[model samples]
Target: MVPIFVIAGIAIGMAAFVLLIQMAVRNGIRMSGLIDWRTQYELERIDDADGGKPTLHELYEIAAKTDSAPDAIERNVRAKALDYIESRNSIHVRNCWIVIGVAVGVCFLAMIITLASSPM
Candidate 1:
C-alpha cells in the first residue's frame, strides 16, 4: 500500500537520524583521543607486565594466572572490549544514517508532489 510505503519511508528517515547521531558520538570519541590512548597504553602495559603481548582472548588467561583481583582484570578487559565494539558500531551507524537519509529524501519529494496536485 502507498500508506505503508510512506510509513516505511518515515521510519527509515528516523533510523537515519539516530544513526547520524551515533556517528557523531563515535567521531567525538576519536577526536577526544581517549579511546586510542587508553587502549594502546593499556595494551602496551599489559604486554610488558604480563611477559608478552596477549591477544584480547589471552588477557583472560593471563588474569587467571595472576594473584591480583579478578575484578580489576575484568574491568580493564571490558574497557578494551567496548572500544572494539564501539569502533564497529560507528561504522554500522554511519551506513544506516546514509540509507535512511536517502529514504527520507525520496519520501519528502513524493509528499510534495502529492500535496501540490490535491484540490483542497
Candidate 2:
C-alpha cells in the first residue's frame, strides 16, 4: 500500500511538471509573430523588464508619430518584442517549475497519509 501511494504520488508529480510545461508553451502565444524562440534573449535583458526600457515597438511607434525615421523604430520594436517574449517566457517556465515542485510535495504527503490509513 505504501508503494502504491508512492507510485501514485510520483505519477501526480510528473503530471504536474508536464502541466507546467504546457502552460509555458501556451503563454508563448502572447509573443506570436513578435518573437522567434531562437534569438529572443539577444534583444533584451530578461532580468530587467522593470529596467525602464521602452519596448522597441513602442519606441518605433512614438518616433514615427514624432516624424522621426521609421526604419530604426520598426526594427527596434521587433527586436524588443522578441526580447520581451523570451524574458517573459523564461519567467513563466521558472514559475511553473516551482508549481510542479510544490505539487509533488503535496502529492507525496497525501500519498503517505493514504497508505498509512490503508490496512489489510
Judged by lDDT, which candidate is best?
2
Backbone clashes counted, model 1: 0
How well is each residue in 8-110 modelled by candidate 2, as lDDT tens digits?
A: 7778878887887777676665446455543454344444557676645455667577556667766656665666666676777787778877887878697
Off by over 4 Å in 1: 37-104, 113-119
> What is candidate 2's local distance difference test score?
0.66
Candidate 2: stretches off by over 4 Å: 1-21, 24-59, 65-67
Estimate the TM-score for candidate 1. Answer: 0.39
lDDT, each prediction: 0.61, 0.66
Q: Number of clashes in model 2?
A: 2
Question: Compared with the true structure, what per-residue lDDT tens digits does model 1 show for residues 24-43?
Answer: 76556654557654464344
TM-score on alpha carbons, each prediction:
0.39, 0.51
